[model samples]
Target chain A: MAKKETPEVNAGSTADIAFLLLIFFLVSTTMSTDTGLSRMLPPIVPQTDDAPPVKERNVFTVLLNYKNQLLVEGEWCEVSDLREKAKEFIENPLDKPNLPEKSDVEVEFFGTYPVSKGVISLQNDRGSQYQAYLQVQNELQAAYNELRNDLAKRKFNKEFKECSDAEQDAIKKIYPQRISEAEPKNIKK
Target chain B: MAKFRKGNKGGQQKINTSSLPDIVFMLLFFFMVSTSMKEVTLLVKIKSPEATELTKLEKKSLVSYIYIGEPLSSKKYGKEPRIQLNDAFATVDDIESYIMAERESMKEADRPKMTVSIKADADTQMGTITDVKQALRKAQALKISYSARKANK
Candidate 1:
């Protein structure tokens, strides 16, 4: 008899094993990417009596009541109209006396350009729904994003995302997103 | 009849499936590479709200998630909304300590770039959310993200 050799393992079941692992990976894997609205919370400030108060015209106040009602700058407005309203408030295209004031700032890419001194203050009632608050926040953010896009398009002839880092910095400096989420107070009435 | 008989005699040859394992292995390798195992087991029922303007969170290691929603077991936990950190249910007070611990555990250089993501349910009241935010502020986790899904057009 010839020398004994090890029996060949069946290859038929190998495909089945790989299929099992593939299925496991397919089920266990979470392919969904994480996305969200990026916001920065103001650092905790010490209680002070002599803090410089912001001017009324310089602050664009957006209030959301518990009923999901929009109270924008002391006027009742709808959510859909917030973007354009906010854009107008930021740009102050006509430089209305009631709107935010602009000061000339020497930017890197662009020479001396006027920058708005506006701070968007968003405050909501404790009883308000999260969905409504987020909607308001989204509208405000959209307003700023639209302005940045338009400026980038005009200055560099490119979209905001396509602009160089320095160009973007200049644009950002010109239209800084300074949304402040204030502490919730008793606004139930 | 003769031609038919001849054709029947020379039936189609069976395909060689010897490389079937190779194909399966290739797919298996692909899935293994692309797979991102879920980081935490969610104890709360969270349905994040939708928003149009979104920034994709980058650098997985730098993100610390804070989940806010009603507990999955509403019977045992009552109907009140809860904050979840990692695997356990936590309170608003626990958030500051949780954030501090998370920051301490990270690399020294990465601590500043760390982002805290608040994944709050759409239906939850703003009261609880406010409390969480206040706690985060005290903890000095200023860079916060409100986790939201992309709004469908």
Candidate 2:
């Protein structure tokens, strides 16, 4: 018999292996979640012996329950109520009789005074729902915007929207204690 | 004799790679057995902020993961921001001390600068998030980042 040459075999098996490995990783890898906001926060100022304590009552308390329910001033209120409440209280500064009779409170000359009514503390109960939490935030922001607009209109005695940026900023900070409180929180027990 | 010599020359030509399948399969098999993929550690949950641009970080730095959420308390203490950094739980105080200590131990050559990759829960309080940011600044580590999933449209 005539000698026969060795036959070649299919080598596509390697390509198949690569394809499988690629597919495996693509399916097996776990995706990461998004971490919110990159804020350039201010330094924490160490308290000095002369430094006055932050006013406790000046804080506005908004509490959230585990059910995501909201309570403003210990009253169960809808998420939409926050903005209106903020606007009503912030703009019409209460006659804070307990506050120092000084014309203005300076940062350098810190003093203890009854917390201004404009300070709002928004608290969420631990059980409060997520959607409710977001709803409350949106309303609070809206309230601040409304307060700003109202202040600008009073300053210009005209349509608030037409007010200059500088004029708006000036009026917004005109009442420094207005809306000076921090954001709402979910306080754990 | 001339025709026979011509046939001999034609038979001497070399074969191309296309004609070889067995050798290619053997190489593929070798690589499959030897190649190993790197394993990545499981990071905490976070809802990254929206950004128009994304950039990768340097490999040499020490990464600290801080989680934003309640400290598993049940009594309801009114509204105060709560946070947990690594194993210790506190309001955001230990953040500065921890980063400072980590910085001190780093080797001169391997000392990577500090940057925090916050992995926060989607339902975490904004106050807690902001508090953590403020703490990082107090720690004097401004090179902070939020871990995010690559967007797939």
Candidate 3:
């Protein structure tokens, strides 16, 4: 019997097949880079019989309702104004009698509580929109960052990010971020 | 002139296609390097809110995503927002175990550096978010990031 010759497969079309697959991925895939607001969740505290009550003066309360209305310290406030309000409350530059109390502990380089010992307490209703909640949170954080930056600038003649580790630590000690987010309350519609 | 004309007629000219495959392969490699496959199929529809104060999550391996939004197939899941962990819809109760599992899967040194990124829809309520946050707190996943788009000026 005569030897049979195997038919040769075509290699010229392989590039076309790869090109099709490449185009499919190029069109369908989204190269999304994730950006976010970084925060640290407070550690869960064990329920004790007697936890000391936080002083009313030490608590800077912010309430957000379902209507996206903001009630800051029992007064209506706009989102745009929250940052300045929070900064004022935290810094208390005027040393108002009703504002947060100054700390007793004093360090050499940093004074005793140029920033207040008060905690910014955020309370939101269950029906409140997440957008509103985040906006408020953003404002609160901005207030802290701005204050810290200002302090860093005054102390070290540098921005917060540009300060040395010890200088940054001192600034943070003076102006610590103390935001307390309360559990969402049920509001009657 | 007659010999030259006869030679040109005897041989048909063809454009060189040897570099075509190389060019195509180069493009393929470029796409392959830039393309990252979708990690988990989204069971919920999420449109993250926009904000000016945004920080990019630098390490992909150090971050785990928790998605919160209404189910895409609303007919089956209803309109209420739900929490999604990885590829499945999870209730608040599932967060502890899910976080523990994720932590266990990582190297011991990397465990402490892990961050939970919550990607929630703009319209979702704060109640769901608070519950998730409580769950994360109990799970000891302290570091958290709320995913949002960069606001346009």
TM for every model, in the order presented, reads 0.93, 0.40, 0.82
| lDDT value, candidate 3, whole model | 0.88
Give a tens-digit lDDT track for model 3, residues A1-189: 599989988768877877887898788666787898988888999889898987888889999999999999999999999999999999888788888888765654776644478899999998899998999989998999999898788877889999888888877778888988876789787
Clashes of 1: 0
TM-score of chain A of each: 0.95, 0.52, 0.79
lDDT scores for all predictions? 0.93, 0.53, 0.88
Per-candidate DockQ vs. reference: 0.72, 0.11, 0.63
Q: For candidate 1, lDDT tens digit of each residue in A12-124?
A: 88889989989999999987778999999999999999989788999999999999999999999999999999999999999999999999999998899999999999999
Best by DockQ: 1
Candidate 2 local lDDT, residue A27: 54
Q: What TM value does model 2 have? A: 0.40
Q: Residues A38-142, candidate 2, lDDT per residue (tens digit)?
A: 323334567578966556544556776676677776678776577777655555456554322224432221233222344555554444544455455546655
Q: Report the lDDT tens digits of candidate 1 across residue range B1-153.
A: 565565445688778887998999999999888778998899999999999999999988899999999999999998798999999999998998999999999999999999999999999999999999999999999999999999998
Model 1, runs deviating above 4 Å: A1-4, B1-16
- Count of backbone clashes, every candidate in sequence: 0, 29, 0
Which residue pairs in candidate 1 collide? none
Candidate 3 chain B, run of 10 with poorest lDDT? B1-10
Candidate 2 Cα errors over 4 Å, as ranges: A1-59, A93-117, A124-134, A157-165, A175-189, B1-121, B125-134, B137-153
